[model samples]
Target: MFSGNGHGKLVGSTQVDELGVLESPVVLTATLSVFRAADALLSWLMERRPDGVSFNPLVGETNDGHLSDIRRRPITEDHVLAAVAQASDGPPAEGCVGAGAGTTALGFKAGIGTSSRTVRTAGRTGTVGALVQSNFGGVLTVLGVPMPADELVPAADRTEPPGNSCMIVVATDLPVDARQLGRLARRAVFAMARVGASFSSTSGDYAIAFTTSDQPPIPDGEIDPVFAAVLDAVEEALLNSLFTAVTTTGVGGRTSHAVPHRAVIERLTAAGRLPAPPLIPESPSETRLRTTPARDEPGS
Candidate 1:
């Protein structure tokens, strides 16, 4: 939730799994600082719960080589605490901020993006969610359609390298375990592909998913379903990141045009990829509830 060198923490977001059954909140950050962020986050938690419990922070990241001050290494405890203190439940920001501040996607400016879907289960409602640090190769196809690379930040050539990376995080209130969550993470790749990303050996296209549905001491009788929720949610969230972002200009006079809204509307409309409202903006605060399950995501 925190941003700007003045107001936000520059450190990576962190999460700690409680014996593979529970996970702390997710954290996003730059590619090289995952360990530092995780260590700091672990320290904060240990001070809060000094029970000798083991908790490994789930840190995700993308390369921020173009726009960020990579050498400064600006993230700090204050930034982490501030972001945590100000966390809210609602739409995530996109374009250039957080871990995405220095990333690219489909050959254009890219950053954080999120989307959600509703699923129906047992006569209730549930939300499958996704959040991504946008950084992927450019000049590719999405759903078989050729997408010209963002000319704004033209690369020297195509087939140069797919150095971009993405930290995809999927979450749900449904019950599921790490194994299932891992599957959901992999499924997120499909969504990324929808956005015109190919799995190059060099690109770190990783996804991490989790569900709050399962509680401690889960009984052997039954286990909650989470794959559908995580997969769908992550897809939506990744789309949200692209949909919400705006273009940015930074160091080296480098210009990275965000997913052009006009182009988005035009292409999606033509392809029937448009969703209602086109996008949603979150408030400083968000609603708190535990909706069950539903399907057909809002947009992504």
Candidate 2:
């Protein structure tokens, strides 16, 4: 795990930091409900383990009070259980869902976002994926292009929260130990700057990275490609969060407007940064297959 700022709560982080292992699925929720979420997660994990064996419940959180009735502590144990039971292996739904339902970021309605990238190193190839709860403040930028200063957001729909935070989870199918995962996690946090994250004093910018491979750990010398892949995937995921989230109104009628997609496209196009649309649209599966490096590539 890597923390750019330590202002926010991340239950189980101390354990993970000391042991370099996460034995439980991560639960993310509103800041005020983190303890409840942790307790619920602990309960769920304990039911599967023998009695008297304590477990650390990995729960992370961001303040969503600006757009939700956080004082109400709306999240319940049932919600956590339901999420666990409904977890899927396929692509996850992103934007304004799950723990990100009432979150805002970069002056826009932001939420859950996900992305993945393939890497080839030495004679092996693997994939790195990132999921982000993007609720941090910054001057919004996409692909190194800053949003136009003249672009006006209505005062009533602005997100002027007192503070912000972001949580990032990274997963890979490469063989790497906790030390390597820690490096990858740091890279993930660094990528936030690519999309204009401020990493403010009041922001909790944390990343947790883990791998699913059981093979021999990759040599540290060959880990560069994987690190590069993390940067790309995380930057894309942050942008995805901003682009896909819809406008939302929450507590006291405070509102957060969605990114102005058309204007952003126009700005990028005018800057000659927008790629032309493909003549032949590819299916999602085909695109995935094409982007992924072959497992048995000649060098790999």
lDDT of 2 at 65: 77
lDDT of 1 at 204: 68
Clashes of each: 30, 0
> Which run of 10 residues does model 2 get worst, by summed lDDT?
283-292
What are the Cα lDDT values of the candidates? 0.56, 0.81
lDDT of 2 by residue, 67-119 (tens): 77777676778888888989989998887787887888887778899999989
